[model samples]
Target: MKNALKEIILAAATAAHQKGIFPSSDFCEVVLEEPKADSHGDLSTNMAMQMAKTQRMSPRKIAETLIDHLDDTRGLIDRTEIAGPGFINFFIRPSAWYPVLAAIHEQDDQYGRCDLGKGTRIQIEFVSSNPTGPLHVGHGRGGAVGDSTANILSFCGFDVQKEYYINDSGRQIQTLGMSVYLRGKELLGETVDFPDTCYQGDYIRDLAGELLEREGRELFDKSEAETIMPCARYAAEKITEGMRADLVDFGVTFDQWFSEQSLYDSGKVAGDIRDFKEKGLIYEKDGALWFKTSDYGDEKDRVVVRQNGQTTYFASDITYHKDKFERGFQKVIDVWGADHHGYIPRMKAAVVASGYDRDQFNVLLVQLVNLLRAGQPVAMSTRAGEFVTLSDVVKEVGRDAARFIFLTRHYESSLDFDLELAKQKTNDNPVYYVQYVHARISSIHRKAGSDGLDVSGFAPSDLSALETREDIVLIKALARYPEAVETAGALREPHRITYYLMTLSAAFHTYYNRHRVLCEDDLKLTRARLYLISAVQKVIRNGLALLGVSAPDAM
Candidate 1:
C-alpha cells in the first residue's frame, strides 16, 4: 500500500508537471509514514513539504497542486487531505485492503520475501568461539543474532552463506593442551604442579580422563613438551565437536567451518604476508614484520610476525579475510562479542589494505547476556562443576524461548535473558505471546473445519464484510511485515522481526476478541475473517522461522 501511494504521488507530480502546474517531472522519492495520531489518516507523506523549498512554492500550495492531480483510477484512495505544514495524508479505501488477503494466500511463505539485495553474494561468520572452552551464554547470543540476521538477509534476496571460524591455533590451544596434560599427569599419579594459566573448567579434567582412556599409559612415554600439540589437537577437536552439536541443537548450522590453522597449514598466511611485503603494505621493523594498517584506517601499525619468526593471530586474520573476498563474496560480515569493539578499525583497515573497500566488510557486535532466574542474576554452580553454558540454558528453557528472547533487543544492547520468564506460558512471555497467535489461528481453522467449512484456501469473494475497523487494522499490520523485514535486513538487525511479530500478534488478538470469525448468519464475513487470519498465521510462521523459532500449531 505504501508502494501504491508512492506510485500515485509520482503520477500526480508527473501529470502536474505536464500541465505546468508543477515545474519539473523529476522529483525526489516519496517518503510515506504511518501517522502517529488516528486523525492524520492511514498514511502520510512529506513529499510536498520536501519539494516546496526547491520548487519555490509554499508546502501547502504544493500539496494542494499534487492533490488536484491525484491519479486514483484503481480506487485506492478514499480521500486525501493537506495536514499542517503541507503533509499529504492519504486515507485508503477499505476496499483497497481486500487484495492483501489474496496476495498473502497466493504468496504464503513467500509473502514477505524481497529482492532488496538483488542476489549480492554475502558471507556472515559468527560464533567463532575458541575451541578451548564450551560455549557460554555470550556465544549463544551471538549465534542467534548471526543465524537470524542471515535468515532475514536471505529472505530479502541476498545470497548469504553462514560461517563459523574456528580459532584452533596459537596460545589458547597450547594452554588448553597444558590444562589437559597436567590433569592427565594427575590421573597418572604424577606430582605435577598445575599452572594458574591453565584452564580451570571441569571439562578440561573430563578431556584429560578421556585422553587417558583413549591413548593409554604407553602414550605417556613422551615428555610433556612433546605431547602438548597432540593434547591440544585432541582437546580442540573434541570441544569443537561439542560446540557443533550444541549449536545445531540451538538451530544454528554454518555453511562453512573455517579453521584458523588452515590458513597456516596452506602456507596462505606466509604467502599473503610476503605479498603484502612486496606491496609495501607490510614492512620489516626491528626484526618483526608489521602491517601498515594505520595507513588504511587503523589507529596504529600492527605487528604481523614477531622477532621470534612466529606469526601473530592478526597475520592469519589478514589472510582469512583476503580469502573471504577471493571466494567471490561481494560483502563479508562478522558477528563478534562486544569486547572486541576496538578491533573493528584494524580489521576494517585490513580489508582496505588487502585491496577491498572497507565498506565491503561489516561487523555486528553482540553484547553480553545477563542470565537471570526470575528477576535475580543466576549463579553458576561451582559445586556441581557447572558453568552457564549455552547447552545448559537450552536444556532448561528450550530453544524457541531462548532464541526468541535473545533477539528481543538489538544485538548491541545488553539483554537480560530471564530463564524463568522464558519458560512461562503466559502473555508476559514474548515468545509464547507471539506463538499463541499462530496456535490460535490454527484453532480457528480447526473450529471452521469442525463446522464443515472448507479451511483449505481463500478465493476471490465479496470481502466487503471486512470493512470493520478491526479488519482494517489487521490488514495494515499484515502489510507492515514485508517492510519490517526489509528494514531489519538493511540494518542487519533481527530484533525488529521480534518487534513486528509482537505487534502483529497484539493486533490479531485485539481483532480476535472484538470480532467472531465463524458466524453462521454471515458465511461471507466468516470466510473473509478466516482468510485474513490465515494470512496472519502464514506471516507469524514466517517471522518465527527468521528467528529460528518454531510456530507450533497448538500450544
Candidate 2:
C-alpha cells in the first residue's frame, strides 16, 4: 500500500510537470507516510512542501496544484485534501483495500516480502560469544535480535548470511583449559589450587569428567603443563557443542561458525598489518605497532601488536572484517554487546583505512538483558559461573515467548525479561495475545465450516458487505503489515514487526468483541468477515514466522 501511494504521488507530480505547472519534471523523491489520526487521511505526503522552494511557490498552492493533476480514474483514492503547511492527504476508498485481502490469500506466507534490498550480499555476524563459557541472558538477547534481524532482511530480498564468530583462540580458552585441568586433578585425588580467574561453572567439571572417561587416567600420568593445551582443546570443543545445541533449541542457525583462530592461522591478521604499513596507516611507537585510528575518527591511536609480538584482538577483528569484504559481501553488520560500543570507532576506522566505504560497515549494539522473576532481579554473575544460561531461560519460558519478549523492545535499550509475565496466557503476555488472535480466527473458520458455509469460495465482491467502521479499521490495520515489514527491514530494526503484530492483534481482538462474525441472517456479511479474519490470521502467522515464533491454530 505504501508503494501504491508512492506511485500515485509520482503520477500526480508528473502530470503537474507535463502541464507546465512547474518549471521542469525533475523533482525530489516522493515521501508518503501514515497520518497520526484516521480523520486526517489514509496517507499523507510532504512532496509538495519539498518542491515549494524549487517551484518558487507557496506549499499550499503547490499542494492544490498537485491534487488538481492527480489521476484517480480507477477510484483508488476516495479524495485528496491539503492540510496545514501544505501537506497532501490521500483518503483511499475502503473498497480499494479489498485487493489486499486477495493478495493475502494468493501470497500466503510470502505476502509481506518486498524487494527493497535488491539482492544485496549482506553478512550479519551476531552472538559471537567466546567458547569458554555458556551463553547467558545477555547473549540470548543478542541471539534473538541477530536472528530476527537476519530473517527480516532475508525476507526483504537481501542475501543475508548469518554468522557466529567464535573467540576460540584467546586467554579465555586457556583459562577454560586450566579450569578443567584443575578439576580433573581434583577428580584424580590430587590437591591442586584453582585460580580465582579460572572458569568455575559446573560445566567445566562435566567436561573434566567426560575427558576422564574418554582419555582415562593416562591424562593424569602427564605433567599438568603437558595436559593444559589438551584440556583446553577438549573443553572448547565441548563448550562449543553445548552452545550450538542451545542456539538450535532457540531456533537460531548460523550460516557460518567463523573461527577467530583461523584468521591468524591464515596469516590474514599479519597481512592486514602489512597492508596498513604499506598504506602508512601503521607506525611503530614505543616498541609496539600502532594503527593511527584517531586519524579516522577514533579518539586515540590503537596498538595492533604488543612489544612481545602478539597481536591484539583488534588486529584479528580488522582482518576478519576485511576477509568478509573479500568474500564478496557488499555490506557487513556486526551485532555486538553494548559494552563494545566504544570499540565501534576503531573498527569503523579500520574498515575505512582498508579502503571500504564507511557506509558499507554497520555495528548494532545490543544492550544488556536483566532477568526478573515476579519483579525481583535474578542474580547472575558470569565470572562467578553462576549466571542464568540461555538454555535456562528457554526452559522456563517457551522459545516463542522468549523470542517475542526479547524483541519486544529495540536492541539499543536494556530489556527487563520477566519470566512470569512471559509465561502468562493472558493479554499481558503479548506472544499469547497474538497467538490467540490467530487461534480465534481459526476457530471462526471451523465454526463457519460446521455451519455449512463455503468460506473458501468467497470472492472480492463479497467484501462489499464490509461497511461497518470496525470492518474498515481492521482492513486498514491489515494493510500496514507489508509497510511495517519493509520499514523494519530497511531500518535494521526487528522490534517494529513486534509493534505491528501487537497493534494488529489488538485491533482484531477489539473487532471480535464488538462484532458478530457468524451472522445467520446475513450470510454474505459473515462470509466477508470470515475472509477478513482469515487474512488477519495469515498476516499474524507470517509476522510470527519472521520472528521465529510459532503461530499455533490453538493456544
Candidate 3:
C-alpha cells in the first residue's frame, strides 16, 4: 500500500510536469509517510514543498496542481487534503485495509517479512568474550541484541552469518592458565604463592581439581613452564564449553566460532603488516612498527608491533577483520561493549587502509546491564569472581523472560533488569502481557469451536460490520506490523519490535475487555471480530519470534 501511494503521487507529478504545469519534468524521488496524529490522515507527503524551487511557484499552489492531477478513480484513496505548508495528506479508503488481513492469513509466519536487503552477504560478530571465566550478565545482554539483530536482518532478506570470536591467544588466556596451574599445585599441599594478577574465580579451582583427577600426582612434578600451557589449554576448553552451553540455553546458536589465534597460526598477521608496509601505511618508530592510523582519522598512529617484537592485539584485530572481508562478506558488524567506543575509529581506519569501504564496516556499541532485585542494585565483581553468571540468570528467570527483558531497551542505552518483575505473571511484565494476548486470542477460538461455530473457516464478505472506531483502530494497528518490522530491520534496532508489540497488545486488551468476541445475537460481528483477532495473534507470534521470545498458546 505504501508503494502504491508513492507510485500514484509520482505519476501525478510526472503528468503535471509534462503538461507544462512545472518547470522540470525530472522528479526522481517521492516520499510517502504516515502522519503521527490519526486526524492528519493515513499517509502524508511533502512532494510539493520539495518541488517549490524547481517549479518556481508557491508550495501550496504546486500542491493544488498535483492534487488536481491525482487519479484516484480506482477507489484506492478516499480523499486528499492539503494541510500545513503544502503537505499532501492521503486518506485511504477503510475497505482498502481488508487486504492486510488477507495478507496476514495467507503469509502466516512470513507476513511481516520484506526483501529490503536483496541478499547482501553480512557478518555479525558478537559476544566475543575471553574464555577466562563464565559469561556474566553483560555478555547475556550482548547475546540477546546480537542474536535478534541477526534474525531481523535475515528476515529482511540479508544473508547473515552469526559468529563468536574466541580470544584464546591473548594475555588473558595465559593468566587463566597460570591461575589454574597455581591452584593445581596448591591442591597438592605445596606452599606456592599465588599472584594478584591470577584469576580469582572458584571455577579455576574446579579446573585444577579436574586436572588432578586426570593426571594425578604427575601434574605436581612438572615444571611451572610446562604446566602453564597444558593448564591454559584445559581451562580455555572447559570455560568455552560452559559459554557455549549457556548460550544454547538462551536460544542463541552461532554459525561459526572463530579463533583469534588462527590469525597468528596462519601467518595472516605478519602478511597483513607486510601488505600495509608495501602500501606505505606502516612505518618503523623507535624499533617498533607503527601503522599510520592518524592519517585515516585515528587519534594517533598505532603500533602494530612492539619494540619487543610481539604484535599488539590491534594488529590481530585488523588481520581478523581483513580475513572477514576476504571471505566475501560485503558488510561486517561488530557488537562490542560500550567501553570499546574508543576502538571504533581505529578499526574503521583499518578497514579503509585495507582497501575496503569504510561504510561497509560498523560497530554496534551495547551498553551495560545493571541487574537489580526489588529496585536494589546487585553487587558484581568480575576480577574477584563474585559476579552473577549468565547461566545463573537464565536458571532463575528462564530463558524467555531473560531474553525479553534484555531486549526491552535499545542497545545504546543501559538496562536495569529487575529480577522480581520478570518473574511475575502480572500485566506489569511486558513479556507476560504480550504472551497473554496470544493466549487470550487462542482461548477465544476454542470457545467459538465449542459453541459449534466454524470460526477458522468463516470468511465474512461484508467487513463493513467492523466499521466501529475500535475495530478500525485495531485494524490499523495490525496493518502497521510490516512497517514496524521494516523500520526495525533498517535501523538495526530490535527494541522497536518490542515497543510495537506492547502497543498492539494494549490495543487488543482494551478492545477485548470492552467488546464481546463470541456474540450469540450477532454472528456476523462475532466472525468478523474473530478473524481480526486471529490476524492479531499471528502478528504477535511473528514479532516475538524475531526477538527469540516464545509465544505460547497457553500462558
Candidate 4:
C-alpha cells in the first residue's frame, strides 16, 4: 500500500509540474496516512503542504491542482477532500480494499514478502555471551530481538547472517574452570578456599561431577599450573553446550558461532596489531602499548597490550571486526547491551584504523530488561548464581509466549518483563490474542466442509458483496501488511511487527464478534467471509512465524 501511495503521489507531482507549479520534478517525500477517526478518510497525504514553499503558492491551491489531476483514478478513489493545512484526504471505494482479500488469498504465506534489500550482504552479531555460565534472561531478550530482526530482514530479501561471537579466550573462562575444580576438590574431601573469581552457579557443580566421574579427582589434585588451563577448557565446553541447547530450545540458531580464541590461535590478532603498528596507528607510552583511537573518535587512547604482556579485550575486538569485513560483508551490525554504549566509538575507530569504512560498522544498543515477579522486581546477583536463566523463563511460560513477550517492545527501550502478565491467556496477552484469531479461522474452515458445502466447486464469491464497514476494516488492515513489513525491515525494528499483529487481531476479533458466518442466510456470502478469514489466518501465521512465535490452529 505504501508503494501504491508513492505511485499516486508521484503522478500527482507530474500533474502539478505540468500546471507550471514547479520548475523541477524533485519534491519532498510526502507522508501518506490513515486518519484516527473513521469519518475522516481512508487514506491521506500531505503532498500539497510539502510543495507549498517550493511552488510559492498557498497549500490549498496546490491541493486543488493535485486533486484535479487525480481524475484518472477509475473509481478506486471514492472522493478527495482538502483537509487541514492543505492535506489531500482520499476516501477510497470499497473496490479498492476488496481486491486486497483476493491478493491475500492468492499470495497466502508470501503476502508481505518484498525485495527492498536487493540481496545486500549484512551480518548481525548478537547474544555473544561468554561460555562461562548459563544464559540468563538478559541474554534471552537479545536472542529474541536479534533472531526476529534477522527473520524480518531476510523476509524482505536481505542476505543476512546471524552470528554469535563466542568470547572463549578470556579470563571468565578461566574462572569457570577454577569454579568447577574447587567444587570437585570439595567433593573429594580436600580443604579448599574458593576465590571470589570462581563461578558460583550450581551448574558448575554438575559439570564438576561429570568431570570427576570421567577423569576422577586426580585431575584437580594436579599442579595448579598444569590443571587450570584444562579445567578452563572443560568448563567452557560445558557452559557452551548448555547455552547452545537453551538457544535452540528458544527457536534461535546462529549461522555462525565465531570464536575469540580462534582469532589468537590463527595469529589474526597479532597480524592486525602489527599492521596497525606499521600504519603508525599504534605506539608505546608508559611501558604500555596503545592504539591512537582518539585520532578517530575515542575520548582517549586505548591500551591494546599492558606492560604485563597480556592483551586487552579491545585488542582482540579489532581483529574480530577485521575478520567480519574480510568475510565480504558490506555492513556489520553488533547488538550489545546499553552498558556498552561507551564502547561503540572505539569499535568504530578500530574499523577506521584498519582501513575500513567507519560507516560500515554499527552498534545497536539493547537497553536492559527488568524482570518482575508478580508486581515486584526480581533481584538477581550473578556472583551469587541467583540469576534467572533464559531456560527458566521458557520452561515456565513456554517458548512462544517468551519470544512474543520479549519482542513486544522496541529494543532500545527498557523492557519491564512482568511474569504475571506474561503467563495470562486472556486479552491482556498479545500472543494469545493473535493465536486465538488463528484458531478461530481454523474453526471456521473446519465447519465449512461439514456444513455440506461443496469443496471442489467452491470459489470465493466476488468481494464486492463484502460491504459491511467491519468487513472493509478487516480488508484494509490486511492490505497494510506489506507496508508494515517494509517499514520494520528498513528500520531493523521487530516491535513494529508486534504492533501490527495486535492491530490485525483486533480487527479480526471485532468482525468475529459482530458477524455470524455459519448461518444459512447466505451460504455463498458465508463462504466468502470464511475465505477472507482464512486469508487473515495465513497472515497471522506468517507474521507470528517471523517473530519465532507459534500460531496453533487448535489453541
List clash counts for every candidate, in order.
0, 0, 0, 0
lDDT for each residue of candidate 4 in 1-555, tens digit (9 for 90 to 100): 555666776787787688776665778886888898877788888878888777787889888887776644545778888888898887888877767877887888889999988998999999999998899998999999999989998999999999999999877777777788888888888889988778887888888888889888789889877777888898788788889999999999999998899999999889988888988899998888899999999999999989997899999999999899899998888889989999999999999988899989987788888999887999999999889999999998889888998888899999988888788989988788889999988877787777876534446454556889988898889988998899999898999999999999999999999988665667667766877788899889989989999989887
lDDT of 4: 0.86
Off by over 4 Å in 3: none
Question: Per-residue lDDT tens digits of candidate 2, residues 1-555?
Answer: 777777777888888888788876778898888899988998898988899889888999989988887777667898889999999998888898888889998999999899999999999999999898888889999999999999999999999999999998867877888899999989989898988899888888889999999999898579878998899989888889999999999999999999999998888888889988988999999999999999999999999999999888999988999899999999999999999989999999999988899999999999999899988999988778999999999998989999999999999999999999999989999899999999999888888878887656666789999988899889889888888999999999999999999999999989999999998888788889988998999999999999999999887
Candidate 4 or 1, higher TM-score: 1
TM per candidate comes to: 0.97, 0.95, 0.96, 0.96
The lDDT per prediction is 0.91, 0.90, 0.91, 0.86
lDDT per residue as tens, model 3, 1-555: 787788888888888988988889867478888798988888899988998888888999999998998886567798889999999999888877888888899999999999978999999999999999999999999999999999999999999999999999978888988999999988988888999899998999999999889988787588888888889998999999999999999999999999998889999999999989998999999999999989988999999999999889999999999999999999999999999999999999999998899999998899999999988999998878899999999999899899989999999999999989999999999899999999999998888888887555466584767877778778889988999999998999999999999999999998998889898877788888888999999999999999999999887
User: How much RMSD separates candidate 2 from the native structure?
Assistant: 1.9
Cα RMSD of all models vs. native, in order, equals 1.7, 1.9, 1.7, 1.7
